[model samples]
Target: NSSDAFLLYRVNEAIRKSGAVVEFVREHIILENMVSIFGNTEKQAELINILFLPIVWGFFHIIKAFFSTPLSALSDKIGRKVTIIFGWTIYTSVYVSFALIVFLPSHIQIPVTFVLFTIYALFYAFTEGTEKALVADMVPEEKRGTAFGMYNLATGVSTLPASIIFGFLYTYFEQQFPGYGGTFAFGFGGSIALLSMILFSFLVKAKNR
Candidate 1:
């Protein structure tokens, strides 16, 4: 649905599949291994890794698509910077919440994940079209193509390593730290989003003022 959401979901999906190399391992990764650190039953945790995950994950996108147009329009009414900051805040919250999933039991997962997914939808709704629109608002018309090109390039460049790091977390770091891999990786991502939001605030004041 959106770039920031796109990026984070990749990390989200990768965290499970990238947990190991073998096909069976990929299918069975994440939930079980994650909960095992706290001594939960593998079978109980495996419940979350099943069909339930996709259904809820897909629902998140539907809600996002439903609200995206209206929320993007909200940017026109308020301001792109404010809307974007709001979206970034939502993204940070989502990332932080996902990271904290380790503390929850398998039974709590359904409601907890559903709530996070719902909130995650709003993140995309706030940022989707607004990101490109913000670029247009900030740059001169004559250089719009170059600006968009640069925006896409930056997003792509960052995505490569972000994927790699996320992939590594569920694979190597999970092995080393047991339950903390996702926590560290997602917490790091949330911190980056928050820092970027703060920096963007200063940029808005500088450019808009």
Candidate 2:
């Protein structure tokens, strides 16, 4: 999910810097092009964080607030494994949809991006606390602390390599494929997420059986 996050960030930044509503530049839409247009990386990043991220996150937090408690309660009723798997499925699907934004007409990009981000917030509501509960359910009471520490450590550690790999993939693909590199990187991340969901589902099934 962190990989997907980083790739999506790049995609959003690219879209923002490209002037989503106007056709100011005619070259391939990548980070460098954004920098070139904006005159520097810092300004471009600032504009996105200040102008774009706020609106997206504002809607996201609203959706998350509305859905979080219900999703957690649903997980308790339906079981953690099922809830987590379903969340991962939504996450993967959202990433795939994010990747496909390049295929859509330019006029709808902002609305579509906001909708996907909102869905992603809902997905987080389902998995965030539920996964920690699943960890607690799996491990013994005595070793719960250590189990959680290791679980968090693994997720945190994986983010560094995930970021590096996806960053490189984005740059490489953008050079090779022009306007489609970010999409490729996002699609790749979504594929990885989908595979993870399937493997986790199998493990959960076997454990329950």
Question: Which portions of model 1 show Cα errors greater than 4 Å?
Answer: 1-48, 170-172, 205-209
Model 1 agreement with the true structure over 60-178: per-residue lDDT tens digits: 88999899999999988888888989999998998888777757654454466668878988988999798889888888899999999999998878887876766666457668997
lDDT agreement with native, every candidate? 0.70, 0.75
The C-alpha stretches of model 2 lying farther than 4 A from their native spots are 3-18, 21-50, 205-209
lDDT of 2 by residue, 132-154 (tens): 88888888899999999999999
lDDT of 1: 0.70
Best by lDDT: 2
The pairs that clash in candidate 2 are none
Model 2 is weakest, by summed lDDT over 10 consecutive residues, at: 19-28
